[model samples]
Target: MAARFRMKRKGVGEMLRMPGMEAEMLRRAEVIKGVAIGLSPVDENGPHPGHYKASWETSSTRRGGRKRDRAVGYVRNTAYYARWVEYGTEKVHAHHVLLRAAQIGGRNQ
Candidate 1:
């Protein structure tokens, strides 16, 4: 007597499109955005005040079809000085807020 077995693959495209996938990705992105905003520096007395913190935004996207199916999350600060605040300038030290937030947020998922 012999046993026969076969493995069937349903593919990942369908799974990528599954009910909560997009929402979950968006949620994670939001988490990252929140963390980034919290870690961002606030110039209380500066001309922009809370502009940097207020610029934090979140976005999510699904792409690459079945073979490379994946969800991407983005947390961005639209402030003109975002780079200066993050990477710092001549007299400032890099804050690395987004980097820290992404590390923390990625661990959350």
Candidate 2:
């Protein structure tokens, strides 16, 4: 004879409704939101990327003959985030999973 154990599955919304789960979810949500919004443009140098140049110019002519010229240059650097992994026998919460997902998604983009 073989022994079998039954497993239960809970929906994300259902898990979050639990007493303490809600707070955890909220806290994690805030962390994710902050990370996403705070790190809009990440670069050590400036807005443009390296190995490239940008410029702007303007000219005008009138009865008096007026002329104007303008130029601009910049380099861009791509943003990146550190990779994280969790390992242990400690219990894992739903909110933690959600927060991790948020962090991963934000970093990837």
In model 2, how large is the Cα lDDT of residue 52? 18
The C-alpha stretches of model 1 lying farther than 4 A from their native spots are 1-10, 17-19, 64-68
Error of 2 at 56 (Å): 33
Residue 46 displacement (Å), model 2? 16
Against the hidden reference, what TM-scores do the models get? 0.76, 0.27
Candidate 2 residues 1-109, lDDT tens each? 8999765554533443454554444454445544433333323485543211111112222111122121111112122311111121345312232244466644644
lDDT of each: 0.81, 0.33
Q: Which predicted model would earn the best lDDT?
A: 1
Question: Candidate 1 has which clashing residue pairs, if any?
Answer: none
Model 2: per-residue Cα lDDT at residue 75 = 17
What's the distance in Å from true for residue 16, model 2?
4.5
